[model samples]
Target: MRSTPPPPQLQVVAVVGPTAAGKSDLGVELARRLGGEVVNADSMQLYRGMDIGTAKLAEDERGGVPHHLLDVWDVRETASVAEYQRAARVEIDRLLAAGRLPVLVGGSGLYVRAAVDRMEFPGTDPEVRAALEEELARGGSGPLHERLAAADPAAAAAILPSNGRRIVRALEVIAITGKPFTAQLPGSDEEQSVYRTLQIGVDVARPELDARITTRVDRMWEAGLPDEVRRLEQAGLREGRTASRALGYQQLLAAFSGAYDEETAREETVRTTRRFARRQDTWFRRDGRVHWLSGAAADRAQLPERAWELVRDALGR
Candidate 1:
């Protein structure tokens, strides 16, 4: 008798969308239904002690589904997309080898792409990076962002204006390769993917999304986001280049520094997050591979089932 061989390669499912678009809840629902696990792609959620502001789901909310790569980084460490890519691939591959489906979920567009897409990271020149850092330090992200927009409009549009670290990295890549940062990512050829993937984009109307973002900000403030930031501040959250600039955390840190009041910070969080969500949508929209679903538009209940159909069909393919 012949020995049994391993199963064929598994197709991964990615639930992606803007902030507060019900991606997490849907991801949990899908994972529970499909006997799969959740792999986080949210950049801000990677930091420890960032639950309230990042809106990280509580243990009870996980519905018994295992979530990987949540709270894996210290508050003092700058979040690295490259590092996250490596870790996420490892986790996704492990799940695949275990004969389980990997449900990739989050709003971080670049991190999501880095995990599933075949992209080459250009080498960084220390001097070039240091020079860009100096510029970012001296003038802030506005000037750098303008330059990036001139050099690579797509990259500038995708990255938030306040994300100095990512801006620097993009500029460094541009300087090193003398090419647009977006050029590093190849087209959506089937062979470019690490695995067969079903990219689902949760779509919501603008007015509803804006309202949801406002409500979320209010909830975060009510949940003692200030106190959480205070604790993380003591742990050097402000010192971390990446963590300090997270949406809610950035506003609160400014308030802490006497730049504004806590109320103003909360208001800014809502405003900026809505704008950031638009950028997130724009980023995912540029990826034609995403299958847009309106199940998140108005609390629609058919999202999970409809998504399952797509997943099921993709698996068969």
Candidate 2:
């Protein structure tokens, strides 16, 4: 008897994992072979002129495969999950209408969640947002976190002190809507099978990932990261909101402000990037959807093709 065939639906292949795991490269190749379009699901990579640090795929790097969402926003502008969801929905519809598979690639678990899940953060109260912004400007995150803790302790506990923007937004939502932020979010189970998603998680030994981070930071330095930051600073993109606080941008800002020399800033970038990678790993590990693969699990040269094969088989191709 012939083997049974898998069900056909809109295919959404998500490549999610820690940073420095070659997600973009794998996703690009997968799209090239599968006749799909790549949609960036990373928050930082969406910003224009953030090429090196965000590890954006160069024009030639895309190998003529169409990609979406890279350089979609100015670095000075904030890109929220809701905004990403909106843009991603449009792209998903376009790709599906074109009869091409959609490949969502990045380490931003939140962005991926926003794309696949139906979220309830649909409307925002301008009054509440303005009030929160005013309060944050005056007293900073301490009072905001306190307010969030009082109203929605779960959200308070889930968000970090360093994540001031999200914490403030959570409180602002609760203040205006009288609902827990988590409760406002749509059902997690709702996203599980919405789009025939195939989740691939790329992993590597911790030490190896750390080495990759170091090497990537060194490469960014060689690629004129200092000059890039100088240009952004000159363009008044230095400080405003969360986008300015991204890993390399913040470090380079520190260097620009004389907080550290170029060498020191680069080292700080690598160190903090590794920590960020660890946090990403922790977050993605909670996602049971991912099929984990190691970089050195096979030869580096053949690994991406092997990963594609695994994804193909997982999709029952």
Candidate 3:
């Protein structure tokens, strides 16, 4: 009698896409269906007290799935993908060891790659970094960002011009490696997977996604996003480089500082978020490993089933 080989011992599922694409809800549904636990990859959602602005699901809304890595960082701490890679891998390993499926969910492309791909971060040079930081401090991020743009236009396009810290880091990397910052990224031919995984990207059309982003921003404002920022500010959010630059929080912080009124801040947040979503889509679409599922507004009702079908097909079940 011939017996079939056993299935792979570890299976990981990731639901990824732009913000306002219902990734969180689909993740919950996948976890429930697969008897899996959820691991959050959203960088902003890792900070405590950032619920409203980051659109983190409330406890009751989690549908009883155990989600790891949410609220893991204080708003005062800077986000580090290296640190996140270590922590997220630990959670994924734990889940796999327990014989439970792990569903990683978020739109943070780099974070997702750090978790599932064999990616290495470049070493930092204190002298070079300090010099860049000093330059940034004296002239602000604009000139340094211009330098980065000339050196690595793709990297610059991916990063927001207002992000001084990231701009400084990119320039530092360029100086250290004597290569474009994007060159350090995992190449299409060179990436290695750390797990046997299924990556499902939630796909939405541009016009529909733009409208959803606008509506989501409006809902955040009505959901007391300003109040949330006010509270986080008191907790030293402005001192945190990463937390202060989050989409809605940054705009609201500027408003609080009288740089702009609340209305202007809200409008700017919508505009910037729409731009950010496009960047996210660009990053994810370049990865051939992602199996995209329809996230169109018109296909809302069938999303979960369609996603599950993909999963089953992948597993050959």
* Candidate achieving the largest lDDT: 3
Model 1 local distance difference test score: 0.90
Model 3 lDDT per residue over 1-317, tens place: 89997867437899999999889999999999999999999999999999999999998999999999999999999899889999999999999889889999999999998998887788899999899889988999999889999999999998878789989988988998899988877754423788878899999999999999999999999999999999999999999989999999999999999999999999999999999999899999998888898899789899999999988987778
lDDT of each: 0.90, 0.81, 0.92
Worst 10 residues of 3 by lDDT: 184-193
Clashing pairs in 2: none
Every model's TM-score? 0.95, 0.87, 0.95
Model 2 spans > 4 angstroms off: 1-10, 138-160, 186-193, 297-299
Kindly list the per-residue Cα lDDT of model 1 for residues 183-301, writing each as its tens digit. Answer: 99767767888877889999998998999899999999899999999999999998998899898999999999999999999999999999999988888887789999985554468
What candidate 1 gets wrong by more than 4 Å, as runs, is: 1-10, 297-299
Q: Give the TM-score of candidate 2.
A: 0.87
**Tens digits of per-residue lDDT for model 2 on 111-195?**
8878876665746778878888898879888888887888887677656655678887887777767778867754545344457
